[model samples]
Target: MSTPSGNGDQTRRDIQQTRAELGETVAALTAKTDVKTRARTKATTAVGGLRGRVTEAGQSAKTRATQLARTVSQKASQRVTSVRQKSQHTVGAIQGSAKASAQTAGKAESSVVTSARAMSTRIGSSVRTKPLPVLAVTGAAATLAVITYRRRRFR
Candidate 1:
């Protein structure tokens, strides 16, 4: 009779422990099913994802901007170098033309001087050879010049 009573008491304790475990599991499941809490967790996850995407976009834009700036800078440098080279070439051409013109002018001046000197020598020799005839011709030329000048002034 005493052994049966002890077995009955042990069975009652086991049932109580099982009931306690079941209650805990039900509480845990109810908490998991709470709509507000689940919504809040989902919202938090979405915000974190959005933040990560925004950071990635910002980094990508920065990289593209840096690359564009480098490209523009390289183009500007090339243009500057090209313009400088062209200007140097133009200046060299102008200098060469100026030097050639100066040389041509110097040669023309020498030619004119030589021709004038030769003409002057010929006239002086001709005058000394026939002084009387030269004087008569000179007087006749002076009289004709006076008559032509008077006619133009009257008209």
Candidate 2:
């Protein structure tokens, strides 16, 4: 009879302790479910997500700009190289034309000199062989020159 009474008392104590722990758990759950606290937590999570997206967008824009700059720089370099090659080709053509023209001019000058020398030799030989006839032809040419000069002056 005494043992049964003690067991009954201990069971009541255990039940009371369990009831107190359950009450504390319910209170904690109620605080966690408050509307203001839940809204604040959600807002903090949303802001963190937005910030991460913005950072990602900024990095993407920077990478695209860098790629575009490199492409533009490469194109400019290629254009410069093309222009330089074209200019070199044009200069080569001009130099070749100048050399050919110089050669032609040299040939023409040589031909003229040779013809003049031949004509001088022929004239010298004719003068030595026939001085009288040459003097008579000279007199006639002098008379014609005087007549032409007088006609121009009268006009």
Clashes of each: 0, 0
Summarize candidate 1's per-residue lDDT along 1-155 as a digit string, tens digits.
35788899999999999999999999999989899998999999999999999999978965775565555555555655664675576556555655665577755455555555655566567558746544444544554465567568869
Task: Judging by TM-score against the true structure, name the best candidate.
Answer: 1
Residues 43-84, model 2: lDDT tens digits: 999999999999999789657755655555555556556646
Score candidate 2 by lDDT: 0.68
List all candidate RMSDs to the true structure: 33.9, 34.0
At residue 40, candidate 1 shows an lDDT of 96
Q: Where is model 1 more than 4 Å wrong at Cα?
A: 1-5, 105-155
